[model samples]
Target: MRLKNKTLATWLTFFGGPLGLHRFYLRGFGDLMGWLLPIPTALGLYGIERVQTYGQDDLWSWLLIPMLGFAIAACALMAIIYGLMTPEKWNARFNPGADPEALPGRTNWFTVVGIAVALMVGTAVLMASLAFSFQRYFEYQIEEARKISQ
Candidate 1:
């Protein structure tokens, strides 16, 4: 097999992880996780559409929107992991036939940038999802409480 580039994998995970492009690139189409990643991503997109059509008060949309955020956050974290992986580990895992010090596994400026981007994006996404889901849930609870008091 051809040598897999760590920098390329890092960027792919950051940009296309939600769609499983990174996983497929590394493990090929038979990777079950690669095939499954898109399901949540699609559901999340559908949720966004539902919110646009039915508004934020839509229960399904509230539940589903977080899925997309979580998926994105997960992918970003994966990118960070890929970026930080040691050259030896990266080669061992993804380019088993290549030398441990293979050039493709070496860290580069692109990988550093990819790591920074992934960290920033992942943290933002995770925070947003948590904030959104909790806000909606608390509002729902307050509404229920008011109904009981009334």
Candidate 2:
């Protein structure tokens, strides 16, 4: 019976955590992961891109290029963190056979799935934006280099 709320929180975090909903459930764990996770996930992806393109002489500028890449990598790390940190929340959210009377709303599985899907989709969009910014910074570096050569 007491496990019902915890189960719901777990399901919510496990499923909809990327978008930050899981933190809302547990408050402490949720907030901590929410703030910390995305930064790494985004940055990790950026770091990978940096390795791929750092060979270009003009692309190796100090703050402008590396900063963007760092941002992306941090974001990627955060995504992973987000997913990993929410396991407790997921467990709390989806104990299917639990007593409804104890926990209040039965909280249908389909609804949980929907929320998770939305969180994932939202996360994808944010990542895309991060990628776009990273690309834009590189493009700016290319343009700046071209001007210098002229």
lDDT of 1 by residue, 1-150 (tens): 788899999999999999999999999999999999999999999999998999888888879999999999999999999999999999999999889999999999989999999999899999999999898888888989999999
What does candidate 2's lDDT look like per residue over 95-141, in tens digits? 33544343333345544554455456556655665675577577877
Which runs of model 2 end up more than 4 angstroms from their true locations?
Answer: 1-21, 27-107
Kindly give the number of clashing pairs for every candidate: 0, 41
Worst 10 residues of 1 by lDDT: 55-64
Each model's lDDT comes to 0.94, 0.48
lDDT of 1 at 111: 97
**Model 1 alpha-carbon drift over 4 Å, by segment:** none
